[model samples]
Target: MNVAVSIDARTALLFSPCRLAGLDLRSRIVMAPMTRCMAEDGVPGPATASYYARRAAADVGLIMSEGIGVDHPAALGEGTFGERNMPVLQGAAAIAGWRAVTDAVHAAGGLIFAQLWHQGPLRRPGSGPQPRAVSCRPDGRWGPLDGSTSAPPDYLEAVRPPTVAMTDNDIADVIAAFGRSAAHAQTAGFDGIALHGAHGYLIDSFLWPETNSRVDAWGRTLAARTRFAVAVIEAVRAAAPALPVAFRYSQWKLQDYDARLVDTPDMLAALLAPLVDAGVDLFDVSTRVFHRPAFAGSPLSLAGWTRRLTGVPAIAVGGVGLSRELKDSLMAVVPAEDNVARAVVAIERGEFDLLGVGRALLADPDWARKLRQGAPLPAFSPAAFATLI
Candidate 1:
């Protein structure tokens, strides 16, 4: 049962060199951010450094560290959901810890970026000293703590009403926190910064109209909704003008899976204009499946549309190296091979400038090296997370 699959380096665009915000990537394969839940109360440590360095040594072109919480009380709620004491990016000690990680990644001959984050209403209101939910609904509650055996919600309350709207000050605080975190990231010696604006998180909350119902300045128009992101970008750019800043965005939200940010290309362009104007160096467009067409009558995927619309470098993610959807893969119902063929095809077609490999990379840090060297991809099991560490 021994077979050798030799991947040609030329055909493997995943390994081809590319430029991002003036920084040269040794290859086009990027190690997407995955929460390890291993930080000490939102503080990273030596092990975190080694965890990232391992992937860099294995040939990851770029390392986007797991979302690091910014220096705000709201940011602390993110780690309460059973993540390892994930490190917060504040104060001298935390900054030094991150600097160690940056040094390790660079020493391994890899470029690393810190993914700045703030959870906003995602935090359970009762969980921390000032636990406040994003939407402030009376029925809103935090999920069960890690490893607790809580019964599932009854069908009636399962579909609880929409979240309470956030005030203007709440939004502004989050934006400022993002900028502060980006500055800390630069201080930590990161090669660049990636804003965690995707996945129905706080930034995405403002971007999507459904979650944001405020009639105020931050909620009236697409440009206004984009204000929070623009402000964060301006602050970060001011902090590190030479550093490349990437924004990760998604049309889908955790609250509503079927959410769509724009129904038309014109709307999409309008929404993105402020970000482009703000000097965002790149865009990381996330989708559940990259192969699916983004809009009706368009052959291009969401990432394709983003690049074409903004004319900025874009990274496409979602089921890149796996065959099945992430949920199915996590459930162990199907092998991961189902998605790889399509991803390879997308790479061949230039649907995106970079490929972001997620769980597969977590399953095997050397996934890129193995794929390019034609080695067998390791079996992807949920247990791989435990095994890797």
Candidate 2:
């Protein structure tokens, strides 16, 4: 529970019901998938359910559960912070655990989607099985996009080795695992599922040319690069025809913030059209900042162009609350109210379907209600983040 919102002019806009890829949501606020890494043995525990239920009760329209691991061996193969708390929904126990989380969210009148994840070459060295990648590139293959070289390497870049390319059977198995998980998600009562194809993760590495050096059909060209994703997306659709499938993608990768999957809008169209045809109903387009023009000279953000090109609903996320870029979000900061209002205006302008709030909600589970009530926001701090899991 959160303090009641008076439903003034600002909050009213975000609370309106909207349809996304045939799945109707109660509001426009989506809980961006924040990795809590609390699952024990890849299974979501009670605290995981409680963590999500708290936000759902506070009026987040939809919750994209933390990157749930697929059955694939290299899926975030090793867990975060030398721990495997990130839920791995590959077993009966994992399925049952997620069922509890879904049950609680539904009880609180919220919609939830499970974000299927795989880390590819970004997997840590000590994380047990070697991570499978589209190519054998090491982490930070493209390095920092900014000219600055002072920033320290994050976990993904520390002690990570080049990943081995997955074989024909390996690729097929990974795709099948996604389908199986999507089927499990539907059985667990989730409204839909999203493929974690951003942040230079497994799916992302496959899309970005620098990381994927394969000569086979899985790579070479943009369409060839998207083959793996299309296979996974199609599998998910076949597993759950009625379940909405949201494809989360980005032009930039964690490996290189300046990374581009395509050079021109024509290229962007070519890349997205086929994925849409493959069965992506909606898109969660990730950017470091929501307001920045995705391409030079255009007012549209990545999500904006995605909507323009695909005509399918898309969600926009980035410093919506804390005003931090995807990389800078790691630091403690304060949430500014003006930026929040600006994001709402973008939504009102129809740039994207929904807005995902990240660090703000992580700072305060009651962020939405507080914003609605014109209450001062608490500063996001290391202490607050420690309590997130």
Candidate 3:
């Protein structure tokens, strides 16, 4: 495809300035958070700061940092692909390290948000900073393994065992941990907070029925299941009143790729209403393909449905620039032309507010600037993931 023609076809609005949650952005393109698992002992260093600063100096509007474990003992652990080096937002060293990252991004004239995460039952036992800490399960059960997945056999066998359910105390502790992490993020100079309420993590496990099969108030009904997320949102909002909070939710999980959080548009609206009311400034809807319809009856994508339902700005992610979905082979050489055209069309139609580029940005930090300049885009290769380019 001709680069000039592609540029002409894309609307200028996509590359134009915009504002989200009171922050001014250079464009609508966002650098989606992709976990690199390179932090040593859960502490980010100079390399981490430089990696984000490079993207900021380019034309990327907003960058979502790699998932940072909340201030809970069991917040992170070895998962698929080994999260042993996962970063955290607690402790003096971790906070100081993140401060450098924020300072670098700011110096480069870019905005960033910290993605707070907790692994929950997906956390491998006898691992993480606190190996003795028991994995927190929603109802003492890992998610059903009898589903389509890309996970390996050994991982499945290890997490197959039943574990202890989260007591009321456990729930309170995790919520407080999120609050504490938010405070730490604020202190470290983060501009905003992004909660990883997706992909079968701790908070997502509570919202998913397959994992959260409790008869108590925490998981009795769809609306009731939102209590955990609501509390976390309220806590983050209180901890950092000036910063915006973005919640990411997905229909699929790493444990089960075909997972569905809601079957209908109305159900999705119901599931997200409380979180919006609880004080979410934006919704980062995760999907395998950004242009795919979210429901059976509507042509709207998941992010589109979210925006229409909750009246909140939604970020659409997943294969924005690459041709293959993230679950596909990382070794394969992925092209960057086709899907980006679709993303431009999606934005022109008002399907989503922000376009999240993951592997493409990982491959090239100047992706946004190149797109804006109508320069050639580099194809993504597995080599890009080996280091913070």
Residue-wise lDDT of candidate 1 within 90-152, one digit each (tens)? 888889888899999999889988888766545444343245434332122222222221212
For candidate 3, the lDDT comes to 0.88
Identify the leading candidate in terms of lDDT. Answer: 3
Give lDDT per model, in order: 0.71, 0.75, 0.88
How much lDDT does candidate 1 score?
0.71
Error of 2 at 152 (Å): 4.8
Model 3 residue 275 CA deviation (Å) reads: 0.3
Displacement of residue 85 (Cα, Å) in model 3 is 1.2
Residue 225, model 1, lDDT = 84
Which order, best to worst by TM-score? 3, 2, 1
Candidate 1 is scored at a TM of 0.87
| Residue 226 accuracy (lDDT) in model 3 | 91
Which order, best to worst by lDDT? 3, 2, 1
Instruction: State the lDDT at 160 in candidate 1.
Output: 34
